[model samples]
Target: MKLLLITAIEEFEKDVINILKNSRLKAFSYQSVKGFKNDKNEMKNWFGKDDIAVDSLLFTVFSEYNCVDSIYKNINEFNSMQQTVPHIHIVTINLEDENFR
Candidate 1:
């Protein structure tokens, strides 16, 4: 088994969920999170800030390797058709031991 972590801005929550469902992901968990970026140039706004915070979501999925691969493919297709900067990010970690009860 592997641990898949997917993160995206809240605005794309529905789309992300759809991707997971289409991938046949049986179970998963997600939570609201604050995403931060430290880009001085992009921070030059009316408030004159050095950083910015974005409302985001983090999804955790534990599944087999094939399932994880399917999710990655789906997310890549979704991101390619986007015309914005924020896109879904996915990472997978190898689980040394899969015993979880």
Candidate 2:
């Protein structure tokens, strides 16, 4: 088993969900989050603020290795076709053991 963590701006929520479904990932969890960036570009700042906050989502999936690989490949394809920033980000961690009681 492995733990998959996927993050992207809230605007891409539907796209993310579609990717997960297409990958045949049966179960997962997600939550809304605030993404922070300390950009020096004044024009990019909101209301002259130095920091920017973006509405984002974090997806957590526990799955087998093969499923993780499929999800990664699908996300890469989705990002490559985009013509903008804030692309989806995904990572995985190996699960050495688990306990359920």
Candidate 3:
């Protein structure tokens, strides 16, 4: 079992979801977040009144390590095909076990 965390820009939220869907990922979670990066990492045009920067975060877990490969491939493909700064960040955590009631 494994856990996949995807933190991406708001604009790519839909793309991420679509990619997950295409990969047959059925269970996942998401939320809208408001935060700011460092001065150098800050967005060039993310200011919206008072210069606040916000973004969306998506998280999902897979029962198999192999299942994650497809999503990673899709994300890589998207990243390679697009010309954008601040690419999405993906974190993978290996789970020892999971209990579901």
lDDT of model 1, residue 71: 91
The CA lDDT at 73 in model 2 is: 90
lDDT by residue for model 3 (21-92), tens: 887765778787764655644554232223447665655656466668988888888878777664666778
Best by TM-score: 1
Give the Cα error of residue 5 in candidate 3, in Å.
Answer: 0.5
Across residues 1-101, which tens digit of lDDT does each residue of candidate 1 receive?
Answer: 88999888898899989988888878999999987767766623212234667788999999877788789988999889887777888889999997776
**Per-residue C-alpha lDDT of model 2 across residues 1-101, encoded as one tens digit per residue:** 88999988888999999999888887999999887767656334222234667788999998877787789898999989987767888888988997622
Candidate 1, residue 93: how far the Cα is off, in Å: 0.3
lDDT of each: 0.81, 0.81, 0.70
Is 1 or 3 the stronger prediction by TM-score? 1
